[model samples]
Target: MPLSVDRLKTLLQDDIKDLTKLSEILNKERTALKERSNTAIQTLASEKSTCIKSIEYRAKEKAKMFVDAGYQIKKGEFEKAIAEIQDPSLQALWRKVNIGLRFCQDQNTINGKVVSHSLKRVNKLMDIVRGQHNKPNLYGSSGKENSFGGLNSIAKA
Candidate 1:
C-alpha cells in the first residue's frame, strides 16, 4: 500500500534532520583539520625563519674573519695571520652550518607540502558535503528560481 502524505513527510523530515546532523559533524571535522594544518604551516614558517637567521649570522661571522685576514694580507702579514688562525675549524663550521640550513629548508618544504595537500583534501570534502546538503533531493525544490519568480511578480506592478 502507498504511504500517507503525513507519514512520507515525517520520513523526509527525519532524513533531513539526520543529514543536517551529519553535515554539521563533517563541518566540525573539517574545521579541526584546517586548524591542524594552519598550526603545521606556522611551525614550518617559524622553523624556516630561525634557520635563515642562524645561517645569516654564521655567514656574517665568517665574512668578518675573512675581512680581518684580508687586511693582514694587504699589510704583508699574511703568514702571521695564517699561522695564528685555524682554517680547518672555520671550514668545518661553514660546512656544518650549510648542511644544517639545507636540512631545515628541506624539512620546511616537506611540512608545507603535506599541510597544503591535507588542506586541499579537507576543502574538497567540505565542498562535497555542502553540495550534498544543497541538492534538491535532500533539501526540496525551493531554490533561486522560486526567489526569482517572486521578484519578477513584484516587478510587474
Candidate 2:
C-alpha cells in the first residue's frame, strides 16, 4: 500500500520533536560530565538511549513507506518523494527534522569527547593512587624521550 503524504509529514514532525529532545539531553550530558555528576549522567544516558531508539524506529517506518511507494531508500530519496507531493509544509518539516538531527549528532560528538578526556584523567589519577610509576613517554620536538624535569614519579609531580 502507498503511504499517504500525511503519514510522511507525521513521521517527519515526530522526528523533529524527538531530535529536539535528544539535543537537549546531549547538552545536559555535557554539563553533567563537566560537573562530574554521576547520577545526572546516568539518568541522561538512559533518556538519550530511549530518544535515539524512538528516532531510529521512526526512520525505519519512513524507509518502509518509501519502499512501499516503489522508491529505493537512498540519499535525497526522501526529499525527492516529498517534492513529488508538492506540499511546501511537508518539505519544511523534513528540512527541520534534518537540521535537528544534525545538531543532535554534533552535540553527541562533543559529549563523547568530554567523556573520553574525563576517563583519561581518571585513569591517570588511578595510576597515581596505586603508586604505579608509569611515566608517560612523551617525545620532544627533537625526537628524544622528554624527561620529567627531575620528578621521580607521578606522585612527586
Candidate 3:
C-alpha cells in the first residue's frame, strides 16, 4: 500500500525532533570532553547511542514508506521528494527537517574531531611519561609511529 504524504511529513517532523535532541547531546558531549570528565562522557555516550538507534529506526521506517510511495529514496532523498510535493505545509516541514539534519551533522562532526584531538593528547602524554618519542598516537605496530620505543615498564618512567 502507498503511504500517505501526511504520514511522511509527520515522520519527518519526528525525525527533526530527534535530530534536535541529538544536536543538544553533542554540544553537551563537547563540554564534557573539554572538561575531561570521563563519567559525564560515559553518560553522554550512552545517551547519544540511544538517540542514534532511535533515529536510525525512524529513518529506516521513513525510507520504507518512501519506497512504498513509488520512489525508492534514501532518507535524505526523501526530503528532496517532499520538497517536490504540491503541499506548501509539507514543504515547510521538510525545510525544517533538512535544516535540523544539517545542524546535527555539523555538531556530530565537531564532537568527533574534539574526541580525536583529546585522544591524541592522551597518547602524547603516555609517550612522554613512558620515555617514548614525543608523538601522539595509540598505535605503534604500523609504520613511522613506531620510530621510538617506550620503556618496557611504566614504573621506570
Candidate 4:
C-alpha cells in the first residue's frame, strides 16, 4: 500500500533532522581544523620573524666591526666577518635562521593547500544540506521534475 501524506511528511521531517545534525557536525569539524591551521601558521610566522631578527643583528654586528676597525668595508670583509665569527652559539643561530626560513615557506604552502581543500569540502557539504532543505514538493504539479535542476537552483539561491 502507498504511504499516506502524513506518514511521508513525518519521514521527510526525520530525514531533515538527520541532515541538519550531520551538517552541524561537519561545520564543527571544519571550524576545529581551521583553528588548528591558523595556530600552525601563527607559530611558523613567529619563528620566521625571530630568525629574521637574528640574521639582521648578525649583519649589523659585522657592519659595526668594519666601521670600528678603520677599514673601508668591502663585500668580502662582510663575508669574512660572518665566516670568522667563531662562537658556536652564533653559528647555531645562523643555521637555525636558514632552517626556519625554509620551514616557514614549506609550511605556508602546505597549509594553504589544506585550507583550500577544506573550504571546498565544506562548500560541497553545505550545498548538499541546502538542496535537501530547499527541495520542491515531489508530488506537486509545479514541482521541478529534475532533481539536479533543484540542486542547481538551491546553489544559485
Candidate 5:
C-alpha cells in the first residue's frame, strides 16, 4: 500500500524541525570556528554529522515512498504530493518545510567555505613552522618584501 498523505505530512513536518535544529548547530559551529576552539569544533562536528545522517535517512525514506507510489521523485515532487491533499493549509505547511531546507542548504555552503579556508591557512602555517616551506614570506629591515627559501632560522635572516 502507498504511504498515507497524513504520514507524509508528519514526516515533512518532522524534517523541517530537524533541519531547523541543524541550522542552529551550523550557527554554533561557525562560532566555534571563529573562536578557534578545537574541542568545541570537534564536538559540534560530531553532532552535525549525526544530525545530517538523520536528515538523509528521512529524505531517502520519502524518496522511496514516492517511487513506490509510481511517482518520479524530483524537484517540486514533494510539494506536488502534498498538494494532492487539496487543502491550502496543508500545502502551505509543507512548502514552508521546503523553503527552510533551501535556506539551510545555502547556509551550509557558506559554512563549508569558511571551514575550507581555515584548513588551507592552517596547512600553510604548519609548513612554515615545520621548516618545510620553500617560500616563507618575510619583511626585511628596509621594509622590503622577501621570501626565504631554506633559511629556517629567523634570527639569522
Candidate 6:
C-alpha cells in the first residue's frame, strides 16, 4: 500500500520543525563556544542531541514510508523518492527539510572547527607548561643545549 500524502506531509512538517530547532541550537552552541561557556555549551549539546534524535526518527519513518510504498531509498536519494511521488506539496516540504538540514550541517562543521582550534591551542599551552616542545633542543649562547626542568619537574622537586 502506498503511503498517504497526508502522512508524508506530517512527517516532513515535523522534520522542518526539528531542523529549525536544531539550527537554532547549533547557532547557540557556536556562541557558547565563542564565549567558552561550558554550562551553556553542555545544555545546548543535550538539546541538540534530543533534536537530532527526533530528526533521525522522522527520517527513518520517512524511509519506512518509502519502503512500504515499494520504493528503494538510497543515500542522498530521499529527494528523488519525493520527486517520484509526484506530489508538489511533498516535494516542496522535502526541499525545505533538505535546505534546513544542509544549514544545520554547515553550522555543525563550523562548531567542529572552532572546537578543533581551541583544543589545539590548549594542547600547545599544556606542552609549553610541561616543557614538552617537539622542537629540537637549540644551543644556548654558552654553547650548551638549553635544558631546564619543566614546571612539573620543579613542582615534584
lDDT per residue for candidate 2 within 1-157, as digits (tens), equals: 7767898888888898899899889989999999999999999999999999999999899899889989997888777888888788988998898889888888998999898888778987998899988776677899866545446575543
lDDT of candidate 6 vs native?
0.87
Q: TM-score of every model?
A: 0.39, 0.82, 0.78, 0.33, 0.73, 0.82
Tens digit per residue, CA lDDT, model 6, 64-128 = 88888877777756667677789998889988988999999999999999998898779769989
Give the runs in model 4 whose Cα sits over 4 Å from its true position: 1-81, 84-89, 130-157
Candidate 2 off by > 4 Å: 137-157
Score candidate 5 by lDDT: 0.81
Each model's backbone clash number: 0, 0, 0, 0, 0, 0
**Model 1: per-residue lDDT, tens digit, 55-127?**
4554454345546445332443433443345455433433444454455445445555666788667766996
Question: How high is the lDDT of residue 76 in model 6?
Answer: 59
**RMSD in order of candidates:** 28.2, 6.9, 6.7, 26.6, 8.7, 9.2
Worst 10 residues of 2 by lDDT: 148-157
Model 3 scores a TM of: 0.78
Candidate 6 worst ten-residue window by lDDT: 148-157
Residue-level error in angstroms, candidate 4, position 30: 12
User: What is the alpha-carbon lDDT for the whole of candidate 4?
Assistant: 0.50
- Residue pairs of candidate 5 with colliding backbone atoms: none
Error of 5 at 60 (Å): 2.1
Off by over 4 Å in 5: 1-3, 131-157
